[model samples]
Target: MKLIAFCSTGMRVAAVAAGIAVLTGCGSLPLPDKPQRPMVYDFGPGLPAASSGPAGAPLALAQVAAPAPLEGLAVNYRLLYAGSGQQPQPYALARWSMSPAQLVSQRLRETLAAQRPVVNVGESLAALELRVDLEEFSQVFDSPGASFGLVRMRATVVAPLTRGERLLGQRTFTARQPAASNDAPGGVKALTDATDDLARQIVAWLAELPVPQGARPVAPAARP
Candidate 1:
């Protein structure tokens, strides 16, 4: 009797173990983890908006007279591939795989014309050339998401190539703006603001500083 009972108990244990193994193999005993979504930036929260500035204008600091009249001014930009220098780099926006030269140039052009009083490079065929080489244009987002941007650049006005006289004194501008969001729209706004902020800085700089003589000062662009 004792032998029979012992064998029966052993057989039951073996059966249970086998059943467990089968269940596990079929994943019946192994529940899957909960499905998860990838992280993304939010457009709300600390992100700034177009109206963030006064009367829908971007944030502005100081506005002074151009050191001298860019009277004979003709503006042209390079909008080159900027390396790592500032915040919210457009390249970084796209995972640092592509270049944002065109976007940056467009933004710069629009901002200079709309925000401040500068000579038109095209209509006038002016003498001085304001050259800008963007060194860095990127954003930084570790864990808080893409919330901050930096724009590093170098600018100078060269006298007509024939003159070989670069403007003396001051001719450079830079700006940084942080973008933070828990979402997507916020990230873009932050990026936009980043661009706006930099533009304002550049405009302010150009406004206050004197332009190198470029075919004598010409009339400002006709008011639109």
Candidate 2:
């Protein structure tokens, strides 16, 4: 019985020593590498100060709306050569700083502010309101080596009514700019250019629209 007791004691000591050795070795083992975060991008310093001077009457700008697929920050692309029906796919290591709709809304406001006073959607100071629906914003690839940024949107100019809204004019706009290269950086650059182009086009369209004479100021809602 004493011999057995001694053996048990010895085994325990050996086991503890082995555990200590394993722990000591772990300190020298290299730690696992950390994952790289995706690169975040946005439209570079917006359109150079508008040379045209301060804009006309205040134009109410609404937050741009987009379909579900474009509501995220992922930088998306579609392969046209692969098939006409290919769905958009996001880049693994890149993303937009914000959703495309947000980016477009911001860009539009900046560009439009150059030509006219731009206000928020609910503001009653402006007789004209501009609402935009972003339909498509993505990089399109014809082949593995070629791509371009494309932006499509529908714009509606409306007059605010005391009860609702009246549409003054509506139009669809699209802009496509060739990628500088076949990669994400190039795609972003192209997309930025396309957005700028689209903004300019919208400005031109607004110039052609006759101001609504019957536009009434939106009345503030009554508290319950």
Return the TM-score for each candidate structure: 0.45, 0.82
TM-score of model number 1: 0.45
In candidate 2, stretches whose alpha carbon ends up further than 4 angstroms from where it belongs are 1-31, 219-224
| Model 2: per-residue Cα lDDT over 1-224, one tens digit each | 99999999999999998878877876555678999899999998787787777658779888898999999999999989989636999999999999999999999999999999898867657888888999999999999898999999999898887768787899999999999999899999999999999999999999888777767768532312
How do the residues 1-224 of candidate 1 rate in per-residue lDDT, one tens digit apiece?
99999999999999999988888776566578987643333222322334332221221111222212111121111112343332221222222111334344556655665643334443343444455555544444544433455456566544433433446334455565655553434444555576566666766665555544334433333321
Q: List the residue pairs that clash in candidate 2.
A: 55-115, 55-116
Error of 1 at 57 (Å): 23
Q: Give the C-alpha miss distance for residue 200 in model 2, angstroms.
A: 0.2
Error of 1 at 170 (Å): 4.9
